[model samples]
Target: MPSAQDIASKLAYITGQLTAGGTNAQMKAWYDEYKKLNVELKEAKAMQKKNPKDPNDLQDPKDLNDPKDPKAT
Candidate 1:
């Protein structure tokens, strides 16, 4: 189970790679992990509805298409 920080880090890295024109293989690998983690995070959140300190609660939902993100720059 990835913590919010871990997810954030992965997302930032993937966004950076995309912005930098990563190779297709690298992009595919990152995308696979990202999708898997996202599903896990959603499930975890649903199961732990009462936790104010839930991991996913710490970060805003990532917008992969957002150009304002630092990694996108």
Candidate 2:
């Protein structure tokens, strides 16, 4: 599986392709992948929100990587 950055970058690429008039088959494939990434992103965000290490204060992701994050560091 690709990293989150990989997935995100590809999603962006696909979005551009769609806007630039890619074939229907290609558009459909990319859109499906984009939707999958959206799901993963949503799950990662939800986990972070629900199980924050510090409810009152949160550290930047660079300083602290939450284990619950689905996006592998």
Candidate 3:
């Protein structure tokens, strides 16, 4: 049960790894792994709808607010 922050962190980590230079084969492997993680994060987020949050639950952080957001950059 990953929180939104956890998903964001994972996305950032993988993005950094891909941008960091690597051999073609190594990049391919990272890409494949990244894809898997992307799917997992999506699934985890979808589950959030089913398990209603408690009244005290924290709100999700908007990626758009990030200064380094891809669209912003």
Each candidate: RMSD: 11.8, 8.9, 10.3
Regions more than 4 Å wrong, model 1: 44-49, 53-73
Can you give the TM-score per candidate against the true fold? 0.48, 0.52, 0.60
- Supply every candidate's count of residue pairs whose N, Cα or C atoms clash at under 3 angstroms: 0, 0, 0
Candidate 2 at 6: error in angstroms? 6.0
Global fold similarity of model 1 (TM-score): 0.48
What is the clash count of model 1? 0
lDDT of 2 by residue, 1-73 (tens): 4444555677788678778877789889878877887887666556657766634324555556668888857
* Model 3 accuracy (lDDT, Cα): 0.72
User: Compared with the true structure, what per-residue lDDT tens digits does model 3 show for residues 30-71?
Assistant: 888789778877886776666646332367454225776676
- Model 1 lDDT, residue 41, Cα: 64
What is the C-alpha local distance difference test score of each model? 0.66, 0.67, 0.72
Which runs of model 2 end up more than 4 angstroms from their true locations? 1-10, 53-73
Better of 2 and 3 by TM-score: 3
- Residue 9, model 3: lDDT of 84
Clash-forming residue pairs, model 1: none
